[model samples]
Target: MQHKTIADTMNLTIDFNDIDDGQFADVIEKIRAERRALLKATQEKYAKSRAQKALIEQQKQRLRVQLQCLYGAVVLIMLSLGWVFSNLEGTTPSLDEPGITHRTIEMTRDHRLDGIQLSQVERYFTAKFLVGDWRFRGANVEGNGITIHIEMPQPLSLEPHYQREYIRNSLCPKGDSELWLSVEPANLTIHLYSDHPSRGQSALCAS
Candidate 1:
């Protein structure tokens, strides 16, 4: 009876050992699930870091584009100012014939004189007088050459009457009519004259 009892106890111990193996399998499965969760968390962290890096790179690219635009604008402004200054420097006046010639003559107006002596430059001798900025009543040929009758806006004594003419030609140089009047008035009278009309002296003026 003692030997039978010993055998039964040994069989019961083997059965318990088999049940413990199944419990160990469940623990191993749980451990595997935890490892998978850890791996997913790590992957998510790496993805977030990569996204941040890409965003930072995009910002840098935008800043670079803006900087390039500002540099281009500065260069363009500098070039434009240089061009304007160069043009201004080239327009300075120099010593040359008809560079800007002004000749004023004195004339005593009298009815016995019958004509006013008009002086002209060689370039304007045969040229038609385009009534530029000169204030004049009438112009015609008198005794010697072309005559320009000047009229003042206010009745002022004759310091001297000036006859003005501007010659227009293809090779005509650029000039301002500033020499004609010191101060510009509201109303002015002007007349056109050409010496080719009368070869001989007329009752007006000689050319």
Candidate 2:
């Protein structure tokens, strides 16, 4: 019984050796096609994974660029605001300090006065009065005279008599021209009248 079983097993093993060439060729082609299909699928999967990673990296780079731009813009805006506030602080005077009163006065220059005379008059006031919180308010030119307004803070007082003498000695010197100065404390108005034979012009006074 053992010898018969061995003979049957040998026959089954040798049966594959009798396969025809056409059948073997077909089997080999089928296996090659399956392997090609599997290789193609693996290649496609790897390519897709790589593309997704590239897209994700691109998105991260774009986000980083946008964040950098936003930070730079924020810094520029902050610097601009700081500059504006600093300029405002420097130009605007504080009102909390005592004896800091706002006052306005007008100084008129006769059109007949030459540039030298005009400069002298300007220099005299700028040197003596335009100091210690005193500032030029504004100026206007009308008709034959130029009017200038000035503001003085607390502790700075413009005495009319002293200013008259100073102007006469400093500006008119040897000339027969007279400098008339009048002050109205209630209205904060100062009228400057220049009486010269060459120029008989009037300075319109307003506060």
Candidate 3:
């Protein structure tokens, strides 16, 4: 008859009624083998788990680095675009008013602008300073004279002498002959005429 009892590591059947001293050694050996096998399995399983955890951590770290790089690249691109747009915006105004701007006036002061440009500048100044809807017809360069032809609307609003002073002082450049503001009553057109005479004309006195 055999009896069943719990051993150290595993279940084994042995005779308890008549104890076999010879078989006891075999049972002990079997239990020792079972413990050794269990230990090896546990150690292998723990080592595999640790390796898996380390690999997962490494993967997570690499993913974090990749995300950071991508974010940095996007920010850099945005900054570059902002700088480019800012410069482009700085170059020109977004809106233009009817009259000449301060920037245009500054351009006229520069001597580099040619004669034709200066005539145009005169038209701009005329529109800005004096009242009325004055249309610039064209500018003429005669022998020593320069005439700015303009179409004025209706009976002269401002004093004719006021226009003459403006033409002599502001419109005319160096070596001017204030030929005067001549008007064609039939067409409501006016001419701001000036000339570089044989004898040089004096500049207007500063007020």
Q: Write the per-residue lDDT of candidate 3 for residues 95-134, one digit (tens) a residue.
A: 2322234544344233222233334434544565376565
- The segments of candidate 1 whose C-alpha lies over 4 angstroms from its true place after superposition are 1-22, 91-207
Q: Estimate each model's TM-score.
A: 0.34, 0.37, 0.38
lDDT of 2 by residue, 1-207 (tens): 112233344354534466576676754565566667778999999999999999999999999999999999999999999888634432222233222224211122222232223333344445655556655432332233433334444321336566544433433323322322312111122223323212211223332
Give the per-residue lDDT of model 1 (tens digit) for 1-207. Answer: 112233344364433354466575664465566667778999999999999999999999999999999999999999999878535432211123111122211111221122211212212322433455333233333233333333223332322222222212211222453312321221122233232222211122211
TM-score, prediction 1: 0.34
Show model 2 residue runs off by greater than 4 Å: 1-18, 91-207
Better of 1 and 3 by TM-score: 3
Q: In model 1, what is the error at residue 107, expressed in angstroms?
A: 38
Candidate lDDT scores, in order, read 0.37, 0.43, 0.46
Model 2 C-alpha RMSD to native: 17.0
Clashing pairs in 2: none
